[model samples]
Target: MTQQEKNFEGSLKIRLYNTKSREVELFQPYFAPRVGIYSCGMTVYGYAHVGHIRTYTNSDVLRRLLEYAGYQVTQVMNVTDVGHMTSDEDAGEDKLELGARREGKTPWEIAEFYEDHFFSTIAECNITRPEVISRATEHIGEQIGLVKRLEDNGYTYKTDVGVIFDTSKFGRYAEFARLDLEGQEAGARVAVDDQRRNPQDFALWITNQPNHIMQWNSPWGRGFPGWHIECSAMAMRYLGDQVDIHTGGIDHIPVHHTNEIAQSECATGRQYVKYWFHSAFLNVDGRKMSKSLNNLYTLDDVRARGYSPLALRYLFLNGFYRRDMNFTWEALESAQRGLARLWGACAELPAPTGVVIPGFIEKFESAISNDLNTMNALAVVSGVLETKGPPESKASTIYKMDEVFGLDLANSRTRLSDFWRLRGLRPEHKMQAESMADKREKARKNKNFSEADRLRDRINNMGFQVEDTPQGPKIVPMFDFDFAAMRKPVCGHCGVDEKTGC
Candidate 1:
């Protein structure tokens, strides 16, 4: 049994679809009790579309699920502010050139614009920054280090074009793709770039031409690190050379990430990463979103059409991670309705006993533990409401589940169709706010002044503050720290803000 399964029973222990085994195998971390994670992030050469959000949210969900399972997770995601090429196969100009040409801006301007906005988008979605958010352009020395190492180990050979890693030297070079080497060249991407020693071998570094805007000085000369080399160097520098989990879009599995694994493992003479995780794509009205197809949806596109970002997240959550989901305005509207209904139901329950329900928490935890089956865990959340329980227990449970869901369930009351804009809550369902309000009001009515203040503080912990007035006690929320902040931050595990001492 996996750690998740062992800890939580009655719920499906998360059986991850391990790319290694090609089956939903029990999730086992390389280092027991502590999990180290790396996620492939944006290239920042162009504007990010909703397609990008799909990948980030998938990673975010995995982080949330792992933490809820009672293991310490240290995650690292990179920012590719430089060195990604137009063709991931190492043939064309840098992608930043394409963005600059299309937008009539400098390559640096394009990178900074999208890179800044990318962080903004993540904040909007409530996805916390990784412990170490590295920039590929800043790590030129590190990439060069790995390139030299691969060269020293005979895993690399310098070609007229650049220094390339010889995939032929590594056993099972295309292992991730489950490819038969006999037919590798026949099916190779970019028509088997003739410069490569073997058809599968990719560039460790590429020479920068006059047209290439993102260039850096290296041992090879004035050039840039190949896209594959950046992730390998960055992941190793922060987490060890071998990591626990590597996540990204399924689209990366064939070419980009495949090259990364070959170069990384060959350079280090050890496993590159364990537990590869790839999320399915999002299709809109039966068509997949992509730049070439010109069907990508931007954040502004969704908002100009009057949709919230969370509405997009809620739509994705309605479907499972491994399955391709169809996105539509109607589908998102339906998710909004579901969210509203959930908040509506939350506004109507009775007062509490201040007791937490361990049994119910265990059940919900198990549901999410089993392969991040949020679809099932959500069903259990609804069940918690239906069952007989203290109002306090039910409220605490929803708050706990939101650790994975990232939904603002504790702060809204617009779901109840029957409930109007009664600022505090609608009396349809039992929410912690209503229960705490009841307690505070009772204390005020009895004139137990000290008890009223303490109950007000209890309400605040559940994400609302209470006040006793002439009419009654009014509740409001000052801060609501969700799952991302619940990790109990490791002191030296500083993020961008923590590193800057912000």
Candidate 2:
């Protein structure tokens, strides 16, 4: 065992809600201090939405907390640049093909454009990039090799369409998901193929499609690998047979992950994964985010509204990862306000002495270790802020907590100043407000209440508000400030404000 593992072996054991057993359990890697995590990444067919942001942020927290607990983690996330069909059952056109058709571009072009946007978006939210980024298109040879092995193991059968994994051959196929096979109806989604063995049978390698933009020579024929096989193959390729943790959104539990378990175990005859972690969905305005409702808000949309991406990340931290989170304009505004306060408080503190209170650290670590309950951890942050203590000590403690929160609180002064500037508070206006606030402070101290009220009104008129703190008076932009002129929607294509009829 490594020194890090040896140190933390007898310490607190991290608990996580494992989907395989549907309960919270103590987590321990097969090899001490060494962990391999496979995260289900985006398909790169479209722009990522807020739901994607929430899922990745939660995964980032998981990885960060594990590292904080002295685990040597290697995280792998796959990019599905090809072979993800619109339908979950391996029917319909490929999503990348559909995106290519939507815009006047090739499938390869669509993949690169959206993949760039997806990573950039997550980076802005301070989500840590995985150690290994595996692409399905680049690993086609490995996928084909995995399918060939399944065929040799007598777990696959060929049909007119493609090579399918016969679920009947694996008796424990439905055990992971606890699915009712008898109640399942065939042909309910896509048209049922007459030669298919069972409804649960999924494609391993698709053939007989001549017009597919991307295809390769496999044992079955000249076609692409199925969606489920791509993840199983690429995960095993990087993480090896002794994979520790697998994470994805909860929607993946039924079809995609279930198929992965069946095919992976049937081929290798070993347990595929130890812990299965799934994040819950994020909703908008108390309804599911959908294109029909036009509520598919992206990080770009959040920036267009003049809110920092970190503010959205802060909102995500307020809820448990296992429960659905509802997003609204008011909630986002409140989160932005709360984050501004945090940044402001950090700015007012003195230089850190590199000393942290042990009680606060213990409470914070305990909260995050309990299945990554960031909500409770955030409460401990509030307690630290409220407790009477030295300024440097509080600063030091909050900065240590930020190691997992990833909020960049160490540079709070610069970030707070930048946040106000991005919110349309001009430097000259900010100076003017500060001057007025200073005069108001003097007037209040001298018992000139009427003069203090007058100065406060003048500061408010300049599109800022003065908040009295123990440190001093702080100048902040008002939430209802008259900055709508600067917030008009811009034409995404031409980069012109919509007010000009672009």
Candidate 3:
């Protein structure tokens, strides 16, 4: 075996910060050489913003590192097409219904449309798709089965609204999140639901809400599964009764994940997850991203503002996943420049000779093993670029590092051209125009100006003008557009105009 292969063999212990334990713990799968991971996925109510991208990116790195460490990993992620409500608690409108109303479409249509956007956005960021993608709507039977188990175990109570998981029956319900049960208020964040015996009790099956757009016939009634129940049900369905790692946003700690633990463990009579992995929130301009502030930037927003989605991924890696990271246009610009240079350096390297610098590989592995310390891992990548070595060795080492980084460094040649063209250009429009331009280029090659003109006209209709340059078609937006300002919706939470910064 090559020396680099030897380096990755054994003695590579991974440590992850378990939100349940409140400390970094050594990661040992319950079953050797096999790891089960379940990451919380998009709700598919709207466009996946940059905040969602950061959490999924962190999850991707975790999965990639496990694979790199030679573990047979089964990663399951859920698409929350239904059940997720506006409030984490059962006190608000169904988010799918809300989105459907806004778009003048059915709940299912809204789900499919936004789900596609989520997948495409993550792809642009180079996040590896989970091996199993479970949708809440598709898994309704499983969700109902889980609720039945909870009911049979006497951990559930029937209410006018539906079947509610009785938090009082679970002794360790608050241990995962360390809740001050006595001090907690019932209606602090969401409206008080008197039907619940305890404020902490969450719904397992929601019923009696005739207005809910997405409904299913369940044992409880003709209703739907609750938001928290879907995750627990879906996670157990694919990854077995217990998962090695269950990842989500830190905001889920107090409510969403805490309820998941309560219901799942109570029903199964065993621990549901060994480790709880949570990523901190991504703030915009040092403030919480708010619709009122007009800062909930989506992947398309990032691209529309002349930045590579991969560059946004790079910015995310520079910060610790457990700590809140602030986002700004300035920071994104810096990330784009740094990524461009790295891609450029890779492009200039000599061809790989199937030799990886062992030292560099070891350091990169060490950083990722320590709670996915991507910021330090990125620093090690910088070190590899500067270290004196045979060019082939350096090239091979960087390529190996890309296994964990997922920067697409192996295709830096294409990225260099793509990245350069993307700068100072609205990437979303440019991307759309470029697709048409490519067809137009093909048509022109075939001496078909009429078809080329048709394609050009389509591009123009989409508010983009294509310039046939020596390099290729240069796509420029016909008008300078402040896409961000166009997204300035009234603050859904604060009930104020965004211009006033409520």
Candidate 4:
């Protein structure tokens, strides 16, 4: 291995809380230099809410950190275009079909519209796209093959409604969730699917009713794959029978992820995934976000409220991924001001022309290494700003740190410049803004409070806000800029700038 690889393997120990193990452990890739990751992606039945965004953002940070640690990482995310039911027990209507009926559109149209919206929303948060995005509708053959493997292995049984996985056959069925099988069997919460052999058994394929819109040919007759099977099939097809990591929301643990472990392990006759990572849910105003409560905030909703999407991203980083984050408008507004302050500080620093300060990068790496503790990593950023150091070294170190934070810190000046140009300001306006900002900093250092306040007010009246940071005083836009309007839509699948639409 090269020196860089040795450094990564030796020093970059990332400890993560594995849901399956129910404890934090050192992350060891199944393979040496290459790592395979599979994250459960959007169902595309509706616009992605803030809860979904939080999950994806956490996954994105994990991927970014791994790549930064000198690993060749391949990430595959599955888009559930079909076969996801409203109820996790597999009794409710298909989510896509339900969305189609609610929106007065075809199922395919509903999937396409929301899929586009999903990509657009994540892009606003600067999320890195996955290397391979697998769609369930496009991988029907693979899903069928997986069901056949399970049946041949005697892990499935025929049911009147569809083929179902025999959870009892898998001895370690509830090991991950530690479920109370007896309680579940005795409770009324279990869906009454008479076809199932046991209360905990879940569907592998669902025989479509005559009115169903999305159906495919299968040995079990015309039907669709189960929600859990789609993820297993697509994940194995792209990554392998076994992967380094699998990630999803905490809601997936008891049913979806447990079922995936049972069926995938039985079919492959090997360990399915080495690490299972789950992110906590986002609550709104100390209550769960529900459509009936009208508190399901989307990226568009944040934009409508004049808060940048990155503000929400920053808010997520403030809390640990495994800890529940409560979202209030008040919290979001505080995060917006926090992000503006960061941008303002970054704007004041000159372009990085010095080498990275020794010990600074190591401090950051250590913080994230400890169970992806982004909250501590953010605190390290604050420490960097407060430390007595050359501006060049601090700027360079922060630019490197943005690889994991994804805050676009290095381009703060460019973003501000673009905003000014879009507002019809000339180049001289930027020069004038910088000059006045310098004068304000000098006055503050000279203890001229009145002069400093006057200069600050002058900058604010010109549509710019001056923020004082540990490093120095900096300037930013008076209000949040519409980052989505700054660029045209780019196709997530095809790397083309789609002027009309993706």
Candidate with top lDDT is 2
Top candidate, metric TM-score = 2
Residue-level lDDT of model 1, residues 1-502, one tens digit each, is 5765345544324567777667777776766567788999898876677778877887888888887766678888888877666664665877887888899998788888999988888766667677888888888999999999888888878876689888888787667888776765553456656667677777888874656877888888888887788888888998888898999998888777888888888777788887888898888778977768777877777655545566667777777888898877778767766765676567664433346577767777776777777777788778888878878778877777888887766654532321222222222212545566786678778999788777665555444556557767665443222212323322121111233431
TM-score for all predictions? 0.77, 0.90, 0.82, 0.85
Q: Roughly what TM-score does model 3 have, to 2 decimal places? A: 0.82
Worst 10 residues of 4 by lDDT: 488-497
Alpha carbon lDDT of each predicted model: 0.73, 0.87, 0.84, 0.83
Candidate 2 vs candidate 4: the lDDT winner is 2
Which 10 residues in a row give candidate 1 its minimum summed lDDT? 489-498
Candidate 3 residue lDDT tens string, 1-502: 4454444447578999998889999888777578899999988887899999999999998888888888888999999998877765664689899989988999999999999999999999999989999999999999999999989989988877788888988888888899999998768877777778888888889888888878889877799988788899899999899899999999999888988888888888889999999999999999999889999999888887778899998999999999999999999989988998898899989888858989888888888899999998889889988988888998999988888889999899888767545543335445556777788899999999998888787667555678888888877554333334433343322223447643
Better structure of 1 and 4 per lDDT: 4
Put down candidate 2 lDDT per residue, 21-96, tens digits, no spaces: 9999998876767899999999999899999999999999999888877788899999999998887556568889
Clash pairs, candidate 3, are none
lDDT for 498 (candidate 1): 30
> In what order do the candidates fall by TM-score, top score first?
2, 4, 3, 1
lDDT assessment of candidate 4 = 0.83
Residue runs of model 3 more than 4 Å from their true location after superposition = 1-11, 88-91, 424-502
Over 4 Å off, model 4: 1-8, 88-91, 185-187, 417-502
